[model samples]
Target: MSPVTYADIEAASQRLAGVANRTPVITSRTVNELTKAQVFFKCENFQRTGSFKFRGAYNALAQLSDRQKQQGVLTYSSGNHAQAIALSGKLLGIATTIVMPQDAPAVKLAATRGYGAQVILYDRATTTREKLAQQLASDRQLTIIPPYDHPQIIAGQGTAAKELLEEVPQLDLLLVCCGGGGLLSGCAIATKSQPNQTNSPSHHPRVIGVEPEQADDAKRSFYTKKLQTIHNPDTIADGARTPSLGKYTFPLVLHYVDDMLTVSEAAILRTMFFLWERLKIVVEPTGALAASALLEGLITIPDTKIGIIISGGNVDLQQISQLLK
Candidate 1:
């Protein structure tokens, strides 16, 4: 499939209309003082199902034909996407099955099951979720909806940027928390589509993808000029622990994304607390990644408006104390 375009995002907006929440754009006076730049946060943390994942999940599932939808759907996720798809499928009257790591956050696993999806847990270190998901799809003849890798999913995700840019037209840079590259890629396509907006001092937005230092597949892929996969990821940002870049998303990232960077786990935790104490947003480590990149100096833009995608809010309760401490 061709990389998602503005037209695709526009169509997705229609499909997702009244279904997806047009989440608020929040500005933090405290964060502005610290970053020394005006920051507009697109609060996907309050999105349906508590993350931006629902945008793509609903859009993708809505596009499936009646027969395919009846066959059900399967996907592999560490957490957010599992819940997103499960909930979306439930809303659409489709059966959903998710293969997740046994170590996935308890809250996420429970939420996925609560959405009526069959949750299959496997060893994160030993078993591959993709392999298991594929087997399940084959045995059950279910349609597979890959997290962050398909055109429909990417197009759906682009709607966030489309809405953000339309609302905050003066943004100079967009910092998106990267996991499997779907959201970032979608934002890139949306941002770059407006030729008058990119590179212009007033409206152009430099798109940057932020990943955890330990799980930097997009960073590696950007440097290698090929789709690179990380073997063993150990990061508090479980949403960003995808082992490899998807074929569909890799090319779009290579072409549209301006740069990719990594933020330390320490920085992520610090930013997570900062958001909670300051903005009063309960963001997960993965959701805090873009802010972490800015605070850690991994990404910088002087005297400009910056938009951050606060990706998700599904924090595991057990990690809450340590993350804040």
Candidate 2:
């Protein structure tokens, strides 16, 4: 696996400075009271395209040559990354084609089309989005922008942490949800670059990765000490349903991530509701995974400064009534 250096992440930060939203770090006295931790919520749900995927998408697109841009790009994503790549491709005057599961959230599918990308839906249970994406890339001669595997994408995603640490440098733990490990890998890069960003000389902020127990590939990977893959994982956190961690991202997470933990589907749903009611934030289940870990006491954040990434808000409203009930 190639090393995702701090320099690569810094370069990505500079490339994305103008394109990505430098979203504010929001804190609440209420959350502080509840967790007994200095809670800084980096609200990427408010980001353009409603997620941090835009930072990486734009960063990768920006690096493409004019000829390559004209040739267009392709990607496979469940939702947030699809919309991010589609929107960024449109903004950069590049055509995009996205492969998504037929059952992806309606809000996300619609948003991807709204960005003018041609969308192709496949079977959620059997059809392989990766194989489809590869075929399309080969047939169309399109540049494949992987959701979480590429160096530029990882670096772009890391910029969010770079900005967060810029605002709050004393974070003791950074909790992020892991799907394909893009965001966590990026966060590791960003936090590792700063002096004393960790609790001590040899440590950085404990970068804890949260995942639903049903689809906890990162957790399995961490424990088994191998790059693990899950076949056809079914989870309500659609955004967290990645089949495996990327080859490029696995080593980084293995090296930098302090720990991995799992939360139940009920915990995810409950936290989703909690954020909606108490925090007044419309966090999708995947976005709320880290908070779910906290709420369930899966990891102790007690009295330490904690950073939780509110990853995205692309929830299907049609399903809300059912989920709420």
**The best candidate in terms of TM-score:** 2
**lDDT (Cα atoms) of all candidates against the true structure:** 0.89, 0.88
lDDT of 2 by residue, 36-91 (tens): 88889999998999999999899999899998899999999988999999999988
Instruction: Give each prediction's root-mean-square deviation over alpha carbons.
Output: 1.8, 1.6
Worst 10 residues of 2 by lDDT: 195-204
TM-score on alpha carbons, each prediction: 0.95, 0.96
| Steric collisions counted per model | 1, 2
lDDT of 2: 0.88
Given candidate 1, what's the lDDT at residue 271? Answer: 88
